[model samples]
Target: MEEKKLNELTNEELLVLKKKSKSTKVINASIIGFCVGIAGYSLFVAGITWPTIFPLLLAVIAYKYLGKNEKAVDAELKSRNLS
Candidate 1:
């Protein structure tokens, strides 16, 4: 029973979860990267050079945060165990 959820899983299961989480993280980061690239190009076309960096930086931050699927899995596993 302790080896079911990601967190509670044995090391072997945890490793599998980590690998899957990495894939999801990469996909999310790619999506965010695509959106950011589009937005940057749009800003460049509009000649909005001065503040465009702000949104670009925001997109990067969002990308980083959104790529943390493993952390979510860990939390969920923990919560499931606690119950």
Candidate 2:
């Protein structure tokens, strides 16, 4: 589907998008935190292993994805002159 241009979006739509973005950020951060905790537990309890590496990998990927997505949302909001 074609996304609406920022200029074409209504104020309410922009606000909704902003709110959704905030929720998404929280979800991503929670996931990253959980993964890090798992990684740390596995590292200490089981030594170097796939369980430790996998969660660490997942955390890195999630962090990167979150950063990229946030930049997009922030840019959109900035362009719209909305916090």
Query: Which candidate has the highest TM-score of all?
Result: 2
Candidate 2 has a TM-score of: 0.78
RMSD of each: 7.0, 2.5
Error of 2 at 20 (Å): 1.6
Task: Please estimate how well model 1 matches the true structure, expressed as its whole-model Cα lDDT.
Answer: 0.64
Candidate number with greatest lDDT: 2
Give lDDT tens digits, candidate 2, residues 6-81: 5576778777877777788889999999999999999999999999999999999999877674576567778767
C-alpha lDDT of all candidate models, in order? 0.64, 0.80
Model 1, 23-83: lDDT tens digits are 7877777777776776778687876674656667777887777655667666655665631
List the candidates' TM-scores in order.
0.51, 0.78
- Backbone collisions counted per model: 0, 0
User: Which clashing pairs does model 2 show?
Assistant: none
